[model samples]
Target chain A: SQTIHQWPATLVQPVGSPLSLECTVEGTSNPNLYWYRQAAGRGLQLLFYSVGIGQISSEVPQNLSASRPQDRQFILSSKKLLLSDSGFYLCAWSVPWQPQHFGDGTRLSIL
Target chain B: GIQVEQSPPDLILQEGANSTLRCNFSDSVNNLQWFHQNPWGQLINLFYIPSGTKQNGRLSATTVATERYSLLYISSSQTTDSGVYFCAPLVSGSRLTFGEGTQLTVNP
Candidate 1:
C-alpha cells in the first residue's frame, strides 16, 4: 500500500520567518504529488502539483513555492511567511487522473 | 478550471440518521472523489467514484459522470461521522479541484 508522510505536524512561526514543509511518498514511484492549503473554515485550495521531478505547477501564485527534488520527495517552502499564510496544509499523491491519497496535514500558524 | 459545487452547505442530524450529500460539476470530469475532513482536520478519502457506485460499510457513493453530478450516502450516521464532506473533481490532469464541502454535524 502507498502512504504519504508530511512533517512538522504543527508549526508556529512569526511573520517574515522562513518556512519549509516536507512530504514524502513511500511504496509508489512516479506518482503525481500535490500541495493544498485550507484556510481556517475554508475549502482546500490547490497550491502546487508535480508530475515528475523538477516539474511544478502553481495554481495561485503567492508567497509559497514547491519543489520536487526527488521522485518521492516534495517540499513546500517560503522565503518569508505572511500572516495570511496561516492554514492547514495537505500533501497528496495519486496515479494519472485518479483519486488522491492525503497525508495527515500540517497546521501552520503564521503569527 | 472546472467548478465544483456541494449541496446542503450545512446539515445537522441525530445519531443513527441517514443523509445524502450531493456534488455537481460545471464540466466533464475524469475523476470524482469524496473525502471526509475530520474535526482534527485530517482528510480521509472516502470514495473514488467517477462513475457507477461504490460502498464502504456505512457509506456509499454514486457518480453520474454524464450528468456531472455525484451523491454520497451515509447510513447510520455516528458522532465520528460529523465533519466536512468534500467532493473533488479531476479534469484534464490528476490535480483535483475541490468543492466548498458539506458540513455535517451528527449529534448524539
Candidate 2:
C-alpha cells in the first residue's frame, strides 16, 4: 500500500519568517505530487503540482513555491511568509487517471 | 480551466437519515473522485466514479460524465459521517480541481 507523510504536523511562524514543509510518498515511484492550501471554512486551493523531479507547476501566484527534489519527495517553501499565508497545507500523490491520496496535513499559524 | 460546483453548501441530518450530495463541473473531466474531510482535517477518498456508479458499504456514488455531474448518496448516516464532502475533477494532466464542498452534520 502507498502512504504519504507530511512533517511538522503543526507549525507556528512569525511574520516574514521562512517556511518549509516536506512531504514524501512510499510504495510508489514517479507519482504526481501536489500542494494545496485550505483557509478556515473554505475549500482547498491548489498551490503547486509536479510531474517529475525538478518540474513544478504553480496553480496560483502567491508567497509559496514547491520543489520536487526526488521522485517521491516534495517540499513547499517560502522565503518570507505573510499573515495571509497561514492555513492548512496538504500534500497529495497520485497517478494518471487515479484518485489522489492525501497526507495528514500541517496546520500553519502565522503571527 | 474547469469550474467545479457542489450543491447544498450545508446540510444537517439526524442519525439514520439519508442524504445526497451533488457536484457539477464545467467542461469535461476524468478521474472524478469524492472525498470526505473529517473534522480532524484528513481527506478520505470515498469514490472514484468517473462515468459510472459504484457502491461501497453504506455509501454509493454515481457520475454522469456526459452530463458533467456526479452524485454521492449516503445511506443511514451516522455521526461519523458528519464532515465536509468534496468532489474533485481531474482535467488535463494530473491536476484535480476541487469543489467548495458540502458540509454535512449528522446529529446523533
Candidate 3:
C-alpha cells in the first residue's frame, strides 16, 4: 500500500516568517503530487500541482510556491508568511486515472 | 474548469437512520470521487464512482455520468459518521474541482 507523509502536522509562525511544509510519497514512483488548502467555511482550493520532477503548476496566485525536487517529494514554501496564510494544508498523490490519496494535513496558524 | 455542487449543505440525522447526499457537476468529468472529512479534519477517500454503483459496508455510491450527477447513501448512520462529505470530480485532466461539501451531523 502507498502512503503520503506530511511533516510538521501543526505549525504556528509569526507574520513575515518563512514557512516550509514537506510531503513525500512512499511505495509509489512518479506519482502526481498536489497541494490544497481549506480555509474556514470554504471548499478545498488547489494551490499547486506537479507532474514530475522539477515541474510545477500554480492554480492560485499567492505567497505560496511548490517545488518537486525528486520523483516522490513535493514541497510547499513561502519566503515570508502572511496572517491570511493560516489554514489547513493537505498534500495528495495520485496515479493516472485514479482517486487521490491525501496526507494527514498541516494546521498552520500565522500570528 | 468544472463546477461541482453538493446538495443539503447541512444534514442532521439520528443514529441508525438513513440518508442520501447528492452531487451535481456542471460539465462532463473523467472521474468522480467521494471523501469523508472527520471532525478532526482527516480526509478519507470513500469512493471513486465514475459511472456505476458501488457499495462498501453501510455506505454506497452511484454516479450517473450521463446526467453529471452522483448520489451517496449512508445507512445505519453512527456518530463516527458525523463530519463533512466532499464530492470531487476531475475534468479532462489530473486536477479535480471540489464542492463546498455536505456537513453531516449524526446524533445518538
Candidate 4:
C-alpha cells in the first residue's frame, strides 16, 4: 500500500520567516504530487503540482513555490512568509487515471 | 477551468439515519472523486466514480457522467461521520477543481 508523509505536523513561524514543508510518497514511483491549502473557513485550494522531477505548475499565484527534488519527494517553500500564508497545508500523490491520496497535513500558524 | 457545486451546504442528522449528498458539475469531466475531511483535518478519498457506482462499508457513491453529477449515500451514519464531504472533478490535465464541500453533522 502507498502512503504519503508530511511534516512538521504543526508549525508556528514568525512573520517574514522562511518556510519549508516536505512531503514524500512510499510504495509508488513517478507519481504526480500536489500541494493544497485550506483556510480556516474555506475549502481546499490547489497551490502547486508536479509531474516529474524539476517540473512544477502553480495553480494559484501566491508567495509559495514548489519543487520536486526526487521521484517521490516534493517540497513547498517560501522565502518570506506572510500572515495570509497561515493555513492547513496538505500534500497528495496520485497516478494517471487514479484518485489522489493525502497526507496528515500541517497546521501552519504565522505569528 | 471547470465549476463544481455541492448541494445542501450543511446537513444535520441523527445516528443510524441515512443521508444522501449531491454534487453537480458545470461541465463534463474526466474524473470525479468524493473525499471526506474529518474534524481533525484528514482527507480520505471515499470514491473515484467518474461514471459509475461504488460502495465501501456504509458509504456508497454514484456518478453520472452524462448528467455531470454525483451522489454519495451514507447508511447508518455514526457520530464519527461528522465532517465535510468534498466533490472534486478533473476537467483536463491533472488539476481537480474542488467544491466548497457539504458539512455533515451526525449527532449521537
Candidate 5:
C-alpha cells in the first residue's frame, strides 16, 4: 500500500519567518508530487507540482516554493512568510494522469 | 485549464437519508475523481470515475463523460459521513483542478 507522510502536522510561525514543510511517500517511486493550499472556506489552490527530482512547476505565483530533493521527497519552503500564507497545506502524490492520494496536511498559522 | 463545479455547496441530511451530489466540468477530461474530506481533514478517495458508473458499498458514482458531469449517490447516510466532498478533474496533462467542494452534514 502507498502512503504519504507530512511533517509538523501543525505549525505557528511569526510573520517574515522562514518556513519549510516536508512530504515523503512510501511504496512508490518516481511518482508525481503536488503542493496545494486551502484557505478557510475556499477551494484547494495548486501551488506547485513536480514530475521528477529538481523539476517543479508553479501554478500560482506566490511567496511559496517547492522542491523535489529525492524520488519520493518533496519540500515546500518560503524564505519569508506572509499573513496570507496561513492555510492548510496538503501534499499529494499520483501516477501520471491518475487519481491522487493526499497526506493528512499541515495546518500553518502565520501570525 | 478545465473548470470543475460542484452543486449544493452545502447539504444537510438526517441519518439513513439518501442524497446525491453533482459535479459539472467545463470541458472534457481524461480523469475525474471524488474525495471525502473527513472532519479531521484527511482526504479519502471514493471514486476514480472518468466515465461510466462504479459502486462501493453504500456509495455509488456515475460519470457521464459525454455530458462532462458526474454524480455521487450516498445511500443511507451516516453521521460519520459528515464532511466535505470534493471533485477534481485531470485535464490534458496530469495536473488536477479541484472544485470548491460540497459540505455535507448528516445528523443522527
Candidate 6:
C-alpha cells in the first residue's frame, strides 16, 4: 500500500528562474528515493538518489540538485534553471536493492 | 556501473497479437525490473524478476541472471498496452539505471 506523491503535476518556468519540485512517500520509512528526468523522446536519466536523510548521490553533473530533508521527503531544486532543464521529472522509492515504485511525473517546461 | 539495453526499439502489433520484449544487461545485477509508462507519463512496475520466471495475468517475465538477460511476454495485446516499456537494473543499491525503452503500439 505504499504510494508516492509529487507536486505541481505540470510546471512552466522562465529561463534563469529558480526551480523546486517535491516528492513524498507514504506507508514506508527509510526507503530509498531517486530523481530521474526524461527528455522528449529520450531515456530516463538518473539525476540523484538518496539512501537516507541528508545523504545524496549524484549520477551526472548538471544544473539540478536533490535533497532528502526527511525520511520520506525528497526535493529537487535548482538555483537558476536552464532551457535544457526542461523535461519530465519522476520521483521513485524502493527498498534496499528492490524494485522501485514511481510517482506520477511532473512535466516541467522551461521557456 | 552497469549498462542495460532493450531490443526492438519500436514495435507495432495489432490487437490480440503476442510480443516479446528483450533486455540485455552488462555486469551482474541483483535486481531486474520491467516498467510500463503509459501515454500519460505514469510509470507502473510490471515485473521484478531478478533470476526467475513469473506470470501475472496476460503478462509474463523471465530473467536469466546467469545469462544477464530478461524477457517480457505480453499475450493478446490491447490498445491499452500501447506505451513505452523500460528495463532497469539495480546492483547492490537502491539506485536503478534504466535502458532506453521500447515503444510498443498495439493498434486496435
Among all windows of 10 consecutive residues in model 1 chain A, the one with the lowest summed lDDT is A92-101
Best candidate according to DockQ: 2
Model 4, C-alpha of A36: deviation from truth (Å):
0.4
Count backbone overlaps in model 5: 0
Which ranges in model 5 have alpha carbons more than 4 Å from their true place?
none
Tens-place lDDT per residue, model 1, A1-111, is 898999989999999999999999999899999999999774899999999999999999899999999999999999999999999999999987567999999999988
Candidate 5, residue A27: the lDDT equals 96
Error of 1 at A30 (Å): 1.1
Pick by lDDT: 2 or 5, better one: 2
Off by over 4 Å in 3: none
User: How does each model score on lDDT?
Assistant: 0.94, 0.94, 0.95, 0.94, 0.94, 0.93
Task: Identify the runs in model 4 with alpha carbons over 4 angstroms from their true place.
Answer: none
Give the worst 10-residue stretch by lDDT in candidate 5 chain A: A92-101
CAPRI grade, predicted model 4 = medium
TM-score between candidate 4 chain A and the true chain A = 0.98
Q: In the order shown, what is each candidate's alpha-carbon RMSD?
A: 0.9, 0.7, 0.7, 0.9, 0.8, 0.9
Model 6 ranges off by over 4 Å: none
List, for all models, the DockQ compared with the true complex: 0.82, 0.85, 0.77, 0.79, 0.79, 0.84
TM-scores of all predicted structures? 0.97, 0.98, 0.98, 0.98, 0.98, 0.98
- Docking outcome class, model 5: medium
Cα lDDT tens digits, model 5, A1-111, are: 999999989999999999999999999889999999999995898899999999999999999899998999999999999999999999999997568999999999999
User: On residues A14-97, what C-alpha lDDT tens digit does candidate 4 reach at each position?
Assistant: 999999999999999899999999998748899999999999999889999999989999999999999999999999999999
